[model samples]
Target: MLKPSIDSLMTKINSKYTLVTVSAYRARRLRENPELFQKSEKSTSVNYVGMALEEIDSEKLTYEVRDKDETTS
Candidate 1:
């Protein structure tokens, strides 16, 4: 077995989902065999592996006011 570089590990963590913890197991597996990762399924909704960074735009979020008519005075 070979050792993985710290830079490679950091890259994986940095690329992972912001709200989720990057799996060490998956990271190691990825480094060991990247082909396996390609065939794997991302069951987690927050998984960022196969997603594009630009897909998560801030403008997509919206907020609404409820029962605010009483404050118009």
Candidate 2:
């Protein structure tokens, strides 16, 4: 079974799309710069994507939504 359930991830994120985007972004970063983020002691995942999900589940990874109007400038 997945360590972080879908329900748990849903609570941290707004939607499944957002969750995928955030996790993908974080996973990319993890791949590029493995030193930037800290891994939890309890994490047993070997791949970056899994690590990303675990981080998100633990609230270590977070995202901010920007309004479209704010980017118009």
Clashes of each: 0, 0
Candidate 2 local lDDT, 5-72, one digit each (tens): 89989989979999999999988999999886667889888888888999999998889999999989
Find the candidate with the highest lDDT and give its number: 2
Q: List the residue pairs that clash in candidate 1.
A: none
Candidate 1 C-alpha lDDT tens digits along 3-37: 22334444434443431233443444455665453
TM-score for predicted model 1 compared with the true structure: 0.23
Q: Which ten residues in a row have the lowest lDDT in candidate 2?
A: 35-44
- In model 2, which regions exceed 4 Å deviation? none
RMSD of 2: 1.2
